[model samples]
Target: METILSATGLLTPGVEYGRVAPLADDADPVKAVGAVVPVQTHSLNVGVLTEPGQSFPDTDALITRLRGVAIGVRTADCIPVLLYAPDIEAVAAVHAGWRGTVGDIVGVTVSRLEAMGADAGRIMAHVGIGICGDCFEVGSELAVCFEDAGLGAFVLPGPFTDRLTGEPMDPDRRHIDLRCANVSRLLRRGIPEANISVAPECTRCSEIAPGPCAASVAGSGMTLAVGSEGKSAARSGVRLPSWRRDHGTTRRMLTWIRLREECPS
Candidate 1:
């Protein structure tokens, strides 16, 4: 079971992390490693774990210092963030959607980890695959919410422009940069710039276009129907079961992280 990315570089020497592909649900190996998954409710809740295999309800993030205990979150298009603090031996797995981003879930998670003696400056963060800025079209109101939250730089107005050509697009398509917003939040919390690594893959268009573009996936079954269908990943078009791409597909990608159990020599 090859993962999208091993993410070994994202953490210190003792932690392991990866984002699972959609097809591997039946044989997910992380569960065998004491994976503690939460019942996500798209909120700002963060669960603190003291043991492995414990479940939390309505949580979008999980953090723990327990060794050998893997914590994870499920997602379709929302961002999956993994954090580690080598100094304190702490780890966290976060699920950030538009809702969680606006509420500053990652910031709160960092605060919680700090409460456990972890230093924000030494914390390593990995912002995994999710909707990219250009592909994530949003309503003006939503854009304003991000702006109000001090994330105005990441918002692009309707009639989106081509990142490659700078050409204007549909008059009705405003967009927000979830990744940039999260990274901004991370930096504001004193997580050093060099310590944060963000995956470039966009769950929506990375698979559908040569370059990620929302217009490419707009009306395609790979995304919500443009006009009639509502708004909304994989290679060849989408390797994961994107809720927007699959049009309400129940399937999801599991993002997990664990502090490795010591190997006996």
Candidate 2:
């Protein structure tokens, strides 16, 4: 009997991306690889790559054709975009923070994948957990950044608050949705909408107070934020996100994808 322990349904049947969980001590999430998988993680400095290893540098994404080696990115309020090409057996793990979104990291990654013989129209993409637009309030400069990049629709008026005072804020300050922006990038690059999946849960709002973990909350469906949805959270007794700075927490969620070695005929 095949007892499915953790079935995320994120990847295809043969795909080997691990839906890992971070430690209870507020550390980065770790994959389910034993001492066998030749997996590698990067510092996720918002840069792109064609290699993988533990070199903690200024890179934010990784792409590789190496089988059995997992590549992952860490995030809290940032978007973790994973791409896979079944034709070429190539996989990519990207960390798309707000800055990365402005820099078109996801688009750049698609270009890199296309360079490696990956058809943008055929590749599968997944936009993982991060802050939602309603929860991610930003300054004018930050909001204009995405608008300048032709993602004006994603930049909307989100709930704004004084970061220092933690009080009600002006309704004018715009909030940016990194997930939507990245998705737009993928669409602009010719990736089919049917080939992409976006996780609808907001990192800050998904956590339930004295309740279920990410798996359970995700098992349900919710998308709220810290300050913006305080009343709702208090009423529902929701927990704060792991790495949500708004909740005064420090932790990261890991998103990974790997290419399994082809079997010998």
Candidate 3:
């Protein structure tokens, strides 16, 4: 399993987190990994999904305080963000597809964390594995989305081949770096650079299970290990199984986080 190390060291002594690698593609994440029961998961749409009532329609993010209740989001090339707010002992799982990114989903989630009394200085975030900027080619429209994100680096020239004319297109196609874009957004919101950890893996180019299929949006959640703060974890979805890849097989790995019951201080 590809894991990211935290430079901020904000996870409560008891907090722990992990992601499903290519080989872990199984029937259920909870059944396979979570040792807890009654975990609450939601069906994700786009744009900061949430489940106030559980699997709520059009919801993309959720905040929970229930020690054993786990929340997560699914994604193919989209970014998955898990937040830990030590003060309120709450966590947030966010789905940042391109549309959601443009809508400032990260900021919204941060705001949600704040509503629960999270402090920017102590908050920890992980920019999970997803499509990097180079692998995610786009058009002039999405290319310009960088302006909104303030990550001017999000858009870049990608290989452009014209199928109809049998020639390479001019100026190249554009690619969007979803990872940097999200990181930039988080930085703008005051989440310390030290507090955010970026996954070392990239789903678009890696040979691992070649997953989060066109239809699968793999996802997961957050939690502390054992100490003064609290605990939590994240797990989530793959694309919904689309035919975009024609003959490609569909697969999705679940990434999750769980907060254990706090230890007696």
Best by lDDT: 1
Residue 184 Cα positional deviation in candidate 3, in Å, after optimal superposition: 1.0
Off by over 4 Å in 1: 1-11, 24-34, 161-169, 208-238, 263-265
Candidate 1 displacement at residue 217 in angstroms: 29
Q: What is the C-alpha lDDT of each candidate?
A: 0.72, 0.63, 0.55
Q: Number of clashes in every candidate structure?
A: 6, 7, 56
lDDT of 2 by residue, 121-229 (tens): 8888888767877668777898777789888999876566543256776687778888989999899999998888776656765542322233433422321221222
Rank list by TM-score: 1, 2, 3
Per-residue lDDT of candidate 1, residues 115-135 (tens digit): 889999999998887877776
Candidate 3: TM-score?
0.67
List the candidates' TM-scores in order.
0.80, 0.72, 0.67
Clashes of 1: 6
Name the runs in model 2 displaced over 4 angstroms: 1-10, 26-28, 31-56, 158-169, 208-248, 261-265
